[model samples]
Target: MNEYDIKDTIAALATAYSKSALAVIRMSGSKALQIASKICFYANNENKNIENFEHRKSYYALIKDENNIPIDELIVLSTLAPNTFTSEDTIEFISHGSIIVIDSLMKLIIKNGARSANKGEFTYRAYINGRIGISEAEAIHDLIDSSNKLMAEASIYKMRGRLTREIDKLRENIKNSLMIVYGELDFPEDDTESFSYNKLIEIFIQIKNDIENILSNSKRVESLINGIKVAILGKVNAGKSSIFNMILENERAIVSNIAGTTRDFLSESIYIENIPFYFMDTAGFHKKADNDIELEGIERAKKCAYESDIILAVFDNSCNANDDDINLIEFLNTLNNKNIIYIINKNDEDKKFNYKIESGNIISISTKTKEGRETLMQALKNHTSDSDIYIFNKESYVNNREKSFLEMGLKQIDICIEKSISSFSLDEIAEEMNILNNIIGNVSGKIDAEEVINEIFANFCIGK
Candidate 1:
């Protein structure tokens, strides 16, 4: 995992191994073409197609075993050298999606020259060959693992070099200022302009402002990548499970009339207007548990509310508000800065509960008739406004490690700014700029390439 040996040919099943119409077995390295040349023959003749091998072209060939008996007919594609995914001689065999065929082909490949690829070895080769940067490599992983449209879109933006362009711009501006500072230090008596403490502080302020913007907008970026966690809490038999089922338009949670039917929380991911929303249905909260199991459920519900970004306080409309409902109301009032939506379930029934909650968001919905579904969706959409969705100038951002690098760079800049106001020399300012530059380099995988590349590709699937 620490190092990748691109010199040895690596092969793996690129496509899924399940039953399908086609599967792809990929190999990349110096001996890829040689191995393919040995095992592959023309479909109509016994002549090997290796002599006529062309890069970026596909040829229908028959793969034969050691006994010269044809094993399978497949399409072999080749991409040579300095213009491939791994920047090496790469060959891919597109064959029928059969486990026996794939296993046979891989065994033949290893027998010929290639070794079985490790997890993300192909992508690691791509990274070392300069085909992609660290952010784009991580973005590729995100793109593959994205669960919703918003997450995919954000990954696309990052993979297309939007973030790299911005980071490069920041580094360019910093380098420009460093050049000026160095010029002043190397030739103080020449025609070069010597900057005062206040003047240098002015320039550093802009860089600090840029870093601060990225740091402050991290939450919005995170919401797009990993959707918001929403918890549903109410008293026993308050139709919390009913509401949970209604929102997903499927019978994901079991709904029953008996109180204390659900003793654990259930979570589901649903998209509302392209925004991913993770909804959790927790066990009902009550004054005192009848048993230890119910008590454990109540404790879990409290934990869910503590970790959620939004809370849906469901209420029953068929009966009057009891002591448990009032206690639930009092508990919700203690949560500050949490988006609480008071949902009155069973709106079709005769309303006997006249409850007043401090929360502004309130809606009445009947789970049986599916009423107020659109209204609730719109309310959720309205909660995530345009500014809340995209707080920064860009649409995507780096991962947690890169965010840490940005924060470290911010701290270094802050130090430079504070020192600029004092009797600090140009040499000291330049030294701080060097440290800031190294931080940015770390963010882009220029420095500490092994750790960054390992972290990025370690999670990727094989043959990526």
Candidate 2:
């Protein structure tokens, strides 16, 4: 009786609705084949015999309206239940990519008894029917939304059950530990020796360590999936905008000889070595502001630098180091967590600004001649190549949702460790272990909830 009843047939255009070479429309449900038979006929103008169609075989068919008017010619692939993505009787129509044709075919199919599929309904059905777990579903969404090759690779790894296997292994270890505790509590008189408190502590510690290891690269993974933010910071007329333009390979920022040309920050994203980097060009830093606008811009620039993962501190080589340059260096020194790269711009001119940071990667370049562009790019790539970002061999990376659950499970394990060491109540420890198991179940989709299902699938595009 619900709107999303799994028993009802659903249809949706799986590909982009544009004029292209071809597009695909997917239909799945118990009556998917029956509905296909109603709207589709063989290329020879004979009625489609659903009984004779082989599973997973493509048949050239002509879609027609109820009045027997031709709609479009498409190849329909029919798949029987329990073997398809949705584990239901499914049909996929590979039709020419025309908006009119797609719309007409969809309408004719819907008219013949299939309802429109909601966003991610196909994947949702797969999840509901035990074809894929929640983590795999999330991975599918991430794969679709991935902006870079590394992100896509990571998503594919998770989608292929790497994360699920890891979680399952963890859950098995926890459950085994819980069994020992439960056995001692339920049968204290058995010949089997009781689980030693020290051994229990050791087991919980190992589990805790395992969880911490899993979460170690979560932040870096998040950055890779989103992007690493790089802020360009320097004094006025230090060629910060020029460097920004060079990196973007476009004249995105206004370059001028006059100071304070960039009154605000501009952000753009590009991929370097398959890694996404978001570059921010902020207004130049100055000790003395000409007006409120310049002062606000300076403050904003400082804020941008503080928030960025990496900072490009530019110094003008055409002029002598002044109070503004000194101030910029002092500010950079305050940022202990930032990866600061010192760039001396305007190397084409006579070298007058000689001040340098005590230690850091410094490069002298002339943005006018486009020199040192490759060096700068390599430097950026080097920073991102750190152990956290370049970890391709990692089994899995947890998203925010999974990370939260892992943290909760870790906290619960710590509690179990404490109780096992100090408390005599094995029941109490078992209770905590049970809670940890539930948390793990949430991540692995062994325990399902309607709200969690809705939230996860809501991010997926329609027809996924």
Candidate 3:
């Protein structure tokens, strides 16, 4: 069968980089092997015939130079039509990773009629060929250039079609509730109900809990997607800035003897083992002169800590914990679920230690000499993380926009469940429950959420 107009094959350099020890040039189309076989230089005795070897197998071959002599030893792997990655036929040439060699080979293949594959085209083909679904294809896009292991696992989990299943389940449950509402209207004189009101309420309660559980972790998911933002905060000279620089492993922030040297927020994105973090060094939290320009910096720092995913509450280990530290601890406690890790800095030297605070996972660290820094990180990880797998391989981060809608739907469901159990008409409750379909429809793009959809999928690769 023919490929596209002027039909042939689709090829791409699959090794990821232009230069490596060897580059695998991948081709998939109706006539991939036919196009490749024309130019391939067979080196081994088994290479006499490209076909009849196997449908999905490799053959030793030599890719010839312009003069038709072998310039490179290549292992040509092919899958026959209808059963390959592209489901048409596929060819992969394991050639030298040298840029010149791969480029020359690709050019030669194109000259023989195969067009260059666009970015993500092969994976797209995998999706088209039923190898994966839309969600899995989306995950494949995240997998290729995932910066952190946690992100990779999340993508992998989503690509495995878990999210699609959940979506289907939720949508189906909503449909069942909607059906019950119509069933009541469809047959009022049946003397019996096809769906029980109590059962409907119970099912919806389960659904509400499911959504609530997903939304409960949505913030943490955002933190993982865009690495946890940690703020190192304390009064000036408490070594908060010093500890920020230490966690980052560089001169990220200036260290000075001056008490108010840092009056602005300085941040760095650092990887903690497999997890990523954006650590901020904030200005001292203290009253400043009315005319002090430095007070603006302190104001920003307060906002920074308030917005932070985690806070490192540092106190001067050289001095006893004072009212400033105690007050700050109390304020951080107000964030409810915020991860605020308390650290007594300068503990490397003898200083008063006040063990009065009830902060979880408190520790001592000396940034000047780098003492207990690793333990500090582990402690911070323990403090901030709700899961040991910070990458959240099992999580599909519902975006903030989606979270809002889901929360709204969940709230409606919560009310509906209450009304259902209280003997208030389920027809009214179903109306409330179906209201969520519009909200979820907006999320799933059952409605025209093209702008949102593009913004999301565009972050994915082209083929994905």
> Can you write out model 2's per-residue Cα lDDT over 64-170, one digit (the tens) per residue?
88877888888999889899999999999999999999999899888889999988889988988999998999999989988778789889999988888888988
Q: Clashing pairs in model 1?
A: none
Residue 373, candidate 2: alpha-carbon lDDT: 89
TM-score of each model, in listed order: 0.90, 0.92, 0.76
What is candidate 3's local distance difference test score? Answer: 0.72
Worst 10 residues of 3 by lDDT: 1-10
lDDT measured at residue 110 in model 3 versus the true structure, 0 to 100: 86
Alpha carbon lDDT of residue 344, candidate 3? 84
Q: How do the candidates rank by lDDT, highest first?
A: 2, 1, 3
Question: Where does the lowest 10-residue lDDT sum fall in candidate 2?
Answer: 45-54
lDDT tens per residue, model 1, 1-464? 43577778999999998888899999999998889989999898866555556889998899998878777898999999989988989999999998889989999999998899988888778878898777888888889998777778888888877777778878988898898888788777884455567777887888888777766676677765587788999999999999899889999998888888889999998888777788899998989889899989988998989888888899999999998899888898788888888899899999978877654799999999989888887877776878876553365676888889998998999999887888687788899988998897777657565565666677999889
User: Which stretches of candidate 3 lie above 4 Å from their native place?
Assistant: 1-9, 45-49, 64-71, 80-86, 178-191, 194-198, 221-227, 245-253, 268-278, 289-293, 317-334, 347-378, 384-395, 399-464
* Per-residue alpha-carbon lDDT of candidate 3 for residues 1-464, written as tens digits (9 for 90 to 100): 02222244678777665578887888887767677767775577424534443687877887775566565787888778677656678788888788888878888888888887665566656654667654565567777867877777776777676665666678788887787677776786673555677887778887887787676665566577678888888987898878987888888788999878887899888777656888889988774434466778777877888778788988887877766676677667677667777888897788886647764768878887898898987876764545735435455766455567778878878777778778787567767777876666544334354354345444544322
| Candidate 2 accuracy as lDDT | 0.86
Distance from true location, Cα of 395 in model 2, Å? 3.4
